[model samples]
Target: MKILIIANSKIVFGRELKEELFQKDKNIDISLLDFASLTLFDNTNQENQTYSKEFLKYKNIPKISMFFRMLYIKKVIQEYNFDIVNIHVSRWFYLLILPTLIKQKLIITFYGSDFYRTSNLIKDIQKVIYKKADAITFTNPLTMKSFLNYYNNFKDKSYVCRFGLKTLDYIDKNRDKSKTEIKQSLGYNSKKIIITCGYNSTKAQQHTKIIESIKKLDDSLLKKIQFIFPMTYGDNLNRENIKNILKSSNLDYIVLEDFLYKDENAYIKLASDIMINILETDSFSGTMQEFLYANNVVITGSWLPYELFDKEGIKYYKIDDTKELKKTITKIVNNMKEYKRDLLVNQDIIYRLSSWKNCIESWVNVY
Candidate 1:
């Protein structure tokens, strides 16, 4: 069977999935197309390497460029005649409604924002796309239900699957190091425990409000905790706003706007004592799972749909508002020993649910 996976290589999960597929079956004929660079990677060849098919980078209006890009994609699908054409992100599905794309089995996977953040017009477009899709995969049941609410006819085609955590190998490698040891090795203060605030620089992360809550903390309490905001990949304006907010406050914080290597990111999560993932919405957060695997106490927004966590018995706290974040943090700080013991129970569950070794077969079965 021939499969074509169209995804941005920058997304860690996309790269991990590509690697997992090759590892699962040596003879599997799969090609990974990085939409950003227009490069394709194939494992069927003797060299098993990537070859570039550079297209002219259009500097024109987005719509005009997008039209050409869609045409190129249509050409690729016709030329390759893949048995399955998997578009890893839902936002790009509008282009797949073209006649050539649906000839083979078409699969569209929905990440969180792509489903939640759509406008009404896009929803109408998605109605058509949903009908054309041979299969639709969602990260969690909550997201699937939300989609089914609007388009119930496609219920049979919809499936709930997760893009499992990719950082487990790195977490295993640092098993010998204590949290304090890991922090010190990474040049962090061993005395102060970490309270990570959100995962990215997106406005949905609500970094400003999180800092507002942090500002309300007692200076003495703030001194014992270091706040970390992973801003490596998102809006620059939002990153600047977060940096400015953090700079004006007396609380100790780090804004990691620069990209970090995989091992570095794993150790940071491992060193964290608490994670505040109060994003506006999410569908089975991989970051939250990674923190759970690293044994960090997680506090999430009640607005976000994470019922899967409860069903799986993954321990976590949820707040109705950002103001509640401070109180929760204070509670976790005072009762660190109890929370640590409770939160540690989540590691096994997270690993079992999220490791690619366990989850990839589901994706293969989908194909």
Candidate 2:
């Protein structure tokens, strides 16, 4: 079957899916259109099709070009006659809204912030888009519920699609060399590891508060846990402020200024024992899923509703206040062995809900 995937600037997710599909079935035929980075008339055989940043900005692009892009995508889909067209994120309403108005098999995944945080007008536009969809996938139940309540319909169109990785098995395969090799490679020498990501600092991610909480930890507990900040991307000034805080705290920590690819991130997860985040209570993180799948202790954001995780048989520690944060850290460090049952349960639930292999097989069916 032929398929076309439309992704905004976050085309990495689509590219990864395309690669995985090819790996699973080399004969599969698929096309990708990164509408956020389109060029007006260049159909040359480049490695990938990309649009410019200006073209993607809803307020910046000329109206005529917008119409042209719509025609370009409509023509591409018609010419290819794809069996399924998947749009990765919903914020690109102008580009995707019209696609749903016509007759076609369409699937849109309401990934992360785009589902709950976009402007109301866009959400209203997507109300019609969601109705027209053959299927809609959400990462977590809370965001899914909020979205469905806003429209109060299309219940059947919604599906919970969590991101899972073959990580545990990957770690098991390289078990012999990994345990020590990775730790030594990264120069981690602490009794335990605590990791937080601030690739980009926004109020939602709460990079500052996370660091300040670490500063609040007592010297004894702080010394035992080596903190690692994957400061992959963010405003330079904000990152510098975080760096200064980390410096003054005198804690065992590593602020990774550069980025690590997916596999590298997995490698770090394998060596670490705790994963932390402070995003919006309802935010569903792809990285959190990876750590959960690895059976490591995952500390989740607090503003979330737990019924969904409970329904899925998932388990995690939730923290909002520094008091809860410090207490959870102490408990985990004191007896990391106690979390085995919870970890195993989480591991089972994640694999059951999010195996990419299963998702691909399901996609082959024209639902």
Candidate 3:
């Protein structure tokens, strides 16, 4: 079956779906969109193992680009014998009407932030799109429930899929570096490491508060720990603000200005000792899942959903007290082996729940 995936494969799940689906069924011809679908699409300008063809790009004005893109998109749909047009993020869900015009089955996948942070206009458009879509996919039940609350008519067509990463994908067989070696390569001499996703906006993640939390730690404790932040996507002011905080303190930290490829990101995610994923609200975080799989101690926001994590018996921290949080860190460090043993069990549970292997058949049926 020929399916045109109107989503960028740069997203971990998007890349996983494209690669895994093709691997499982060679006859299924899968193609991903080359340009923006409103999310970051480029994988460090690296050549995609799958097919990619460039289309309209912004040349200073967005309206002009959209006009040309509409013409090209419609022309492509007419020429290619696509049986299914799968839209990944709801940012462009309004464009689902285009595939319907050509009688192609339209499947819209709602990523959490797109559906969760909707404007009035998008909500109105979603009501219309939901009625027309042949199928819809969500990463978690929370996002799906949110969509249903707005427009529940398409209940039968909706499906829930989770995201996960394989350990082998991050581990370089050729390089085969140990955890210690990976840390050394990154110029991290200290054995202690804490990772925080600073690429998120201030709302999703408390960037300033997180930084201050680290600052609040004792200087002796701070000296022993290395703070690693992936801050490529934040604004300059936020970046400078973080830099100033890092500078004023004697703490050793690394702020990655450039975005890392998935493999590199996975490596860092694997190597970190602890991760802070304190967020205001979220459906599910692929990064948090990665950290859990890696068996790293993770600090998350108490406000976010944790029913699944609680059921899985995953060991996570959502404590707000800095002193108490530090004490917990000390406790974990003292009995690291037992905590790791528990994490192994949690990892197996999460793997069973999040693996793409379990969802492949359903994905095929969506088409």
Candidate 4:
């Protein structure tokens, strides 16, 4: 079957989901359609290289751009003759207003931001899209609930399908490097490494607080910990913010240079001693799942959508308590082996839950 995916961009979870689907079924032809290029201004020359202004401009653009995009989308849909058309971002729902001159099974996938932070006009557009679609896919149950609350008639078409990751069967083959060597390569030494994946945005309001907490640590404890922030998109604002924090506090750390996406990310997860998801709120964070599968100690904020821990693993910190975060770090350093053992047990459960095979199987059945 031919499936066309229309999204804001060909990056982040969109790319990951595309890769997972194609790997599972070679017979399914998958194509990505992105509207990010439609924006007139490019911020590639800015000091921080952030596209915040560009994003704002795109949102506030004259109706001409939106109409042009709808016409372009309709043209592509007609020419491709796809068996199924799935729209990934809610903003693209404007295309649904065009009459169904060519009837194809339609679906909409609701990611967190599309449901929580979008404007009322977008939500109304989504309701219309939901009415027109054959099915609706949600990344988590919380998103499904949000959609239902917004449009009561969508119950029959909505389905919850969790995101999945590609598995690594031979991850141990590259484990010969000593922790000291790995630390040296990253320009650090024997410190407890805490890694956070993805961009730094104001929407992630809790990040500044996390940095403040790190700064509050005593010199003895601070010298034993290193913070690593990796940026995936949004110019280099995330990198710059992290750099400024490190400089102001005189802390030693590493920020990775940008590289194309690859499977090596799993290895980086495995190398870290701890992973943090400090989002103000999240339906799900793929980075958190990846770290759990890698058997790393995880510290997350209290607003996590679900309880990621069972009887023996994972740690939760209150957003207001820097002291509690410091205490957790101390506990992990003093009892590393116990934490590692708990994580090893949890790894098996995480592996079964996040396998790409299972996710694709669910998707195929949904249709």
Candidate 5:
């Protein structure tokens, strides 16, 4: 079978999933297309194909660029004669509005925000796109339920297809290293490393709110723990503001604004004693799952759709709002041993759910 997986290059999972698919079944030919760069990548020659300069000259214009991109993608799919064309992130459905663009079995995968936060015009466009889709997949059940609430007619075609952990292999390699050893290697002292605030530099992360809450804690209590904010990506302007907040907050903190290498990220996760993810909305967060795999006590927002973790018997804390974040942190700090032990007990369950080796079959079945 021949397959084509298309997604934004910025989303790393597109490439990871492509590699895993080929590893699972060597006979099945697979190719990945970066929608933004209009680059096509394949395993055999590891070749990359991009649009001609003549066509790319008009790329600055939105409508013209999208038109040519759609035309180019249609031509490529026809030339390759791929049996299945899977488009990740349903928001890109605007690019596939024309039914004739894809003749083979077409799958549309929703990545949370795409389905939950669309304008009426995009909704109309997706409504048309959904009619042409052969199947639809969501990363979590909550997102699926949200989709079903609107488009009940596609109930049979919609399936929950979560991606496997990209960090599972790295976690295995670093599992033997004790948290203390990893912390020392990373230049951190004996202080408990609490990965505070949230995952990124987005306004949704509510970094200021978290900082404010931490400021309310007593200085003596604060001295016992070290806070690390993973502001590696997202709004650059907001990142600077968060740095200022951390500077003035008087808390012992590290603001990570630089891009983290794979090894660096793995070591950071291993060293962390707690992870706080209070993002406004999330599907299935890869970072949150990674911390759980590393046995870090994770605290998330009650508003986020993380029912799968509860169903899998994973132990993690949740707060209703930023107000509860301070209280939760205080409790975890006071009872560090208990929180760590609870998370450690569910290590095997997280590993089983996150391992791509276990997850690849479900994706295959979806195909």
Candidate 6:
């Protein structure tokens, strides 16, 4: 089958998924077209630094290139003669709305943000696409529930295609190193590390709650723990906020300002004692899956629906009781061995549920 995968950009997960699919099934011809590359920046007069900011705002709002790109994508679809046109990002409604015009089988994959908090108009457009597509895949149950609630008729077409990881199978290979050795290498003391990572200050990730929780901890308890914030992008904003928070708090922490993207698994899992994901809403988090794979105790916010936690192997903290976050962290730190064993058993269950093999099998059967 010839599949055309369209996405907004060539981010880590996007690139990894494309490579995995092609490597597993060479018989399947897969082509990737990123709208980010197609949308050029108007850098005729602006400084280099200002160009990207201007371009991002223009691209995000979709006012600058929707019509022209929709026409271009339609032409590309016809020219390529693809059997299946799979869209990864929801914003591609500029093209998917005209699926009837393209004369090809359509598949739509819903990542987290688009379904959780979008305008009614965008949601309506998404509903039309959902109704028209041959199949719709959601990375997590929360997104699937959102869709099912919005469009009752889509019950037959929707399927849960949970997020997966390649590294899970071999995660145990790197567990030989002692936690103390890993901490020393990373320039952190042997204190318990509580790591939370996301984009700088997105309200959806709800990182401020994690920071506030740490700040509220008693100084006696706080002295034994350290925080690490490994932001993916927007260094300046994140750095300033982190700096201000650190200055105000008695807690020890580090903000890795270089913005590490590659080796995220090694840095986050190996260097830290525990991983925290406090998102207001999440369809599925690749980071959460990674932490589970590495057998690290993961504490996430409790706002997620029951469907998202159907096959869980991690602990959850209520969003309202963030003050209890520090106490939970203390318990994990005090009984690290017991928690580690629980995490190992949990990883086994998670591996069975979210292994790439299982995910690929489901994908093949979806059509």
Better of 3 and 6 by TM-score: 3
TM-score of 3: 0.82
Model 4 accuracy (lDDT, Cα):
0.61
Model 6 lDDT tens row, 190-290:
75655554434455655677777777767776777778776544335656776686778776777665534344446556666677777667677766766
Q: For residues 1-367, what per-residue lDDT tens digits would candidate 2 score against the true structure?
A: 6667776433245665665666666676766677645532212214443334434555255666666566566766776677878877774544453653345678887776776678787777667666677898876777788888888898887877654455545654544565567777667763455554533544566767677666777787876778777666545677787778778777778877666655565677777778776666445565666667766687766675556666787878877774477777778777788874567777656666666765555444433
Q: If the candidates were sorted by their TM-score against the true structure, best first, what order would they fall in? A: 1, 5, 3, 6, 4, 2
Highest lDDT model number = 1
Q: Which stretches of candidate 5 lie over 4 Å from their true place?
A: 44-49, 52-72, 75-79, 92-97, 184-192, 257-262
- Candidate 2 stretches greater than 4 Å from native: 8-13, 23-27, 34-46, 49-83, 95-104, 140-142, 176-178, 190-192, 197-202, 233-241, 244-248, 320-323, 340-342
lDDT of 2 at 21: 65
Per-candidate count of clashing residue pairs (backbone under 3 Å): 0, 6, 0, 1, 0, 0
Q: Note the Cα lDDT for every prediction shown.
A: 0.80, 0.65, 0.64, 0.61, 0.79, 0.64
Which portions of model 3 show Cα errors greater than 4 Å?
Answer: 35-59, 62-71, 96-102, 167-177, 197-203, 232-249, 261-263, 320-341
Off by over 4 Å in 4: 8-12, 38-71, 92-102, 119-121, 167-202, 235-239, 308-324
lDDT of 3: 0.64
Greater-lDDT candidate between 1 and 3? 1
**Model 4, 1-367: lDDT tens per residue?**
8777666552456555666677777677776666554321111211221323334445457876566556566766676687887777666445445365227888777777667777777677656566778888888777788778877777998898776765333233434556566555545455465544333334363555666666666787667667766554444575577667667775556665554234455456656777666666667666676666666777776655654443334433333453366667667766778887766565566656666656767677665
Candidate 6 regions exceeding 4 Å error are: 8-12, 39-62, 65-79, 92-101, 184-187, 190-194, 197-201, 233-249, 257-264, 306-320
The candidate that achieves the highest TM-score relative to the unseen native structure? 1
In the order shown, the candidates' Cα RMSDs to the true structure are 2.7, 4.6, 4.3, 6.0, 2.9, 5.7
Query: For candidate 5, which ten residues in a row score worst on lDDT?
Result: 93-102
Kindly provide the TM-score of model 1 when superposed on the true structure, using C-alpha atoms: 0.91
Which is superior by TM-score, 2 or 4? 4
Comparing 5 and 6 on lDDT, the stronger one: 5
